[model samples]
Target: MTTPAKPTKNFRFVTGNDPDFFKDKKIVSANRSFVMFQQAKKPCDGIDPLKPQPQRVEKASKRCDASRPQPRTASIPAGAVTETPCPPGMSSDDALGLFRGDRRARKRLVDRPQPNQRVLNQILSLKAEDLPFATPNATDMCSFYALLQTEAAQGVLASRGKLTDGQLLFEAAYEGFMSTFPLRVVGSPHDTFEVLPKFKGDFKSSMEELKCHCSATFSCPNLGRTWIPKATSSKLSFLSTLCISAAHLDAMRGERSIWAPLMGQMIPLLRIMTADRTLNTSDQAIISVLQVLLGTMIACQEVSSNIHWQGLAQLVTLRGGLLQLDPVIAMMISIHSVESSILSESPIVPEYLEFLRQRRERSQPGQPIRYSPLYSNQVELMELRHDPYCSHNTYELLCDIYSLTNLISIMRSPIAELKNFQSLDDMEAERQSICARIACLPSAFSGDSKDLSRRARIVRYRFESCRIAALIYSNAILNGCSFSYAASQITPAFASSVKKDPAPRQNGRNTRSDSLPSIYRNRPVTITSYLKQLLARSDTSGLWGPLSGVLLFVALIGGTAARENLPVPTSATDLGTDSYNVKDRSWMAAVAVRCGVQLGFEYQGTMEKTLVALADVTRMSERCDSAVVEGWRASQEPEILEKSLHDGNGSLGNTSAPQTRFTEATTNEIHIERVSEGWPSTTGQADPSSIDWGFLNGI
Candidate 1:
């Protein structure tokens, strides 16, 4: 049927080649298709192409799913920043204030403050009866050492798992020990002497363990997860290093490993804080505490390095100036500056003076704070006494000492860079002013004997010794020997030569031996007698007083004076014509040396070396004196005289006889011998037991 319908020519498909297709076709075309459709059409398709079909529409569903709620995001305004608000119970402003030293917000977080909850918790963990003995006390010499060891062990174990917990525990233990320990009992013979060395060992060992735990926790790979940040770790290391070095300061003598590492860490952090010039009370408190601790070390000569001094001083200025420093630290720094100036013969006083002036200027206008009100009973118990003459306390006395010593220091400088004293006349006026101030101080021995405690006695001794040293050194400077050179040259070996002539007496002042310009030079016997008295009293006082540092300097001065050719005192207050021999003076110097050794400055080897050299020189002088007498007798011999007269020869018969210049020749020989022989080892060679340090050990 389909084939039958296709027989029609109009219905059949035809190609362009069909004769009828071209004959019937017109050139006209249907209306143009859409340009979009035409342009998108395939090349295979002719000019016309099919249009795109519309997408199919789907009906909306009425069912709802109620399990999940859509998120409600408020539209952010253009150019507006979005931030999360602070949670309830915390003020955003207060939280922000913390960086500026606002403590109110943080104080609220601490539930308890009075009893130091952390310290209380630690104390509760230990046996209650052992609490009194945890620190060194009158009753227990080596108290709390066993407890400290236990704490250290537990800390090490906990540090491996929870580092912050271990650190807190160790800090608690150290604080406990520091709070309880009475440092006065350390060198007191009334307590036990044998216990000190043991206690020191235990203390050092505990500090070492703490340091190890800190290092381990910090170096661990997962430190990021731990509670202690890098900054906290560094703080702990600094504290640990400080404690260890302080405990062993007598022997450490500025060991770089003991101090440098911790200082290195602290300096950078301090620099950052100082550079920003931000007011942070916490940082100020930290620096103040550090100053006290480090100043203590300096006072004890435990640290001789000035590496951090200038930097620390600048930091202190930025914090709140010198007045902001803790009272104990201030006192110690003053003492340290004086001692350093004297020893080095340089004036650190000018810079220190500027610091003080700035502090005074910054202080509020009120009655000047003579002593810091924030006193620590545990730390400054020994310095707590009041001196009525100064109207305040020992602090004023320290200020007085600093003032006088500062002037002396300036005077001693070759250039004398002081504005008040530019010439020798100006120096003399300033010197008189200082001498008057010293004279105004009541005699150290004037106090009633019955009222003196062990600490009082030490204070008295220290004051007297410092006063003596000032007088001696000042006079030496006036005599044309620079104070800087005098300190070193005043050693017993050189004193005799340095003072070939008698020191000039102060103008119109002879009320007492102490008032004399050159007390050591003019009245050796008087000074030695008083020093001997001090030594004898210390021997019986049941306290080991070696005159540490400043005190030792005083003793050395006395010893040096004892070697000079000066007459002994005929009466208690009067100098006499009768003089002690060289051998006797040497013995006197030996006494001073022995006293110095008792105080533990023996490691310095200064006093010991000076005494030994002085003794050798004394013996040489005695030998020369004997040879002189023999030569005089030989000259009187008739046969030798006649032979010399007849021969007209200037040469003597004997070549071995000493001449009048024997003393000078022997002095040169003595120095040469010392160099060649390498000088006898002073510190290590001597056996502590054999040297009769029994006085130090005795009760």
Candidate 2:
């Protein structure tokens, strides 16, 4: 028998039944089977199993007979094997298909007539070699930007009702801008305000140049004014829109790295762009930009600290600030600045007043009332917008309260320097003016002829609370103690001085009694009255929201009253205090805490600190009261008197002229429930002897 097999040089196949048949028979059988298997694997006329595979087979090389390694075959071509130029006038869909990896689609795209024939040809002709420095010229880039703007706007509008995959559109637009206007802003992946580096060309000139590159013919006539180069406005408007949209997505999904930096970069640019001389500051375009900036700042909690808030201050100071700014935004900036100033203890009272003045100057006779972003964004909250007639009055009321707070800050500084006497006369005059102004404003709490809104009620409560707080400040200032000075005076030496009378000086004047402010001097009734009003307003519901904003101010007033050695108000008319007769100002301090809790804000990270601080102040106030009472008692007790008589009680005998003892109290635990329900019970006896006067200023 013969095996019809090709033989390798390493071995040979032998026919059957020859000499050496045993060894050769085994080898010959194996060789014949292997040869048949190899033939089976190869393409055949019709019988090969693997022959129909599309992958080209490699020819095995003769190296060392069956043991040589095989090399990998290419799956697809890495580069164009042949040039296939797209015909001019191809449709964009077919042209875009090339990017989608449909090689046949490139040919199909050439079947249509393209309007941008030249641009289409240039794009199709691009090779790996031409990409390094390749760029579209000015006109082409501008056209391209227009195309991108349309696409981005369509995407934005499509997703307006809900945020869904919305970030992709903005992200693409932002990426395009960054690539096209490379020098406009420079920063790492994360920066709050990215702008051109200082080493670059003049920032203004560079920005103008960048804006000019994208300048097109489109205009938003509705935005008012044609001064802003159409392209410049469009580019900025698109960026701002993209940024805010992305921020909305981020706000919902919390993709922190995505939107935070986008806003951080965009807000500063918007500020700089609005400040650009090329754009009319009062143009509707710039106004829209500012509104978005302010709105984003208001909406995003993370943005609160990163933005250049002072830029808003500068804008408000400009002639265009008020003219261009919406009254709602201006009011927000004013309120926010004042709140921040009070917190930092570095007052920006002048800026706030300036914003208020601008808002008034721009106020029109019959314009619709404006609402804050929170109200505007929520349908439920929209009802909080006050009537047009009452809107101006509402803000005016707020302005008066802010002015009083400014005065209080000014008084504190002078009092701190002990030069308060120089300003006292001026402050007192201003105080009376402010009071008369506050009184002239329609009551926030009462009698509505045309309208009464929840916001109006909130405003009324705010006005009343601020009015009472201002009174407390003035009361402290009049009695030879500014709030700061009074806060600093909670010491052992000061506590000891509480019981002493003014000795007759050689000048024939009483040292202690003469310098006291008349409002707080020789009368516990006035201090008690102010404390009662402050506590009443503190517990009032309408003011519950802004209470947190003005917490420190309220705490200061409460602190002053609590440490004044005056009894808590016994008036049954005070909101929740009808059941308890208070003896110290601790209840007043507790009022701030309870109001914060009732508003469901006590658990906030920010308010938690305020609560701790309030508690500390309350505890300190109680300790101080105990010290004053104990010191007074030691002076009044008969046993001590007999001992002092025997010991010739030096100054203690001279000061025991009068003492009014209410029930004693000690450091009582503050109760939010009792505080919310009513004033805390005054059942426990207090000992003033344990008071630590040294740390009062520390609190």
Q: Using lDDT as the measure, which candidate wins?
A: 2
Q: Where is model 1 poorest over a 10-residue stretch in terms of lDDT?
A: 56-65
Q: What is the lDDT of residue 326 in candidate 1?
A: 53
Stretches > 4 Å off in candidate 1: 1-165, 168-282, 285-305, 316-345, 349-351, 355-471, 480-484, 491-699
Clash count of each predicted structure: 1, 11
| Sequence-dependent TM-score of model 1 | 0.28
Instruction: Residues 297-338, candidate 2: write the lDDT tens digits.
Output: 323232353344555555555645554565434544454443
- What lDDT tens digits, residue by residue, belong to model 1 across residues 1-699? 343222321121222334553343111010111222234444454565543321110000101112435344442321121132212443444434443465662354543323333443445464312322123223222223333345543564454443343333333333344323222323333322122111211232334543453343223232223212312332322333343233233212222233333343344444444454442234443433343334233222223425445555555665576567554334334433333333323334554434332332223355222221111122332343433222233334444444544555455455565444347666555555543343234445543444556656655554554554554443343222332222222222122221212334468543222321222333333344444434434332222222232334444445444443222211222322224322222333333322332321212232223222222222223333333333444444658656776889634433243221101122212111111132221111222221121111111
lDDT of each: 0.34, 0.36
Off by over 4 Å in 2: 1-138, 141-262, 265-268, 271-276, 280-307, 313-344, 349-699
* TM-scores of the models, in the order given: 0.28, 0.28
Whole-model lDDT for model 2 versus the true structure?
A: 0.36
Which pairs clash in the backbone of model 1?
A: 546-599
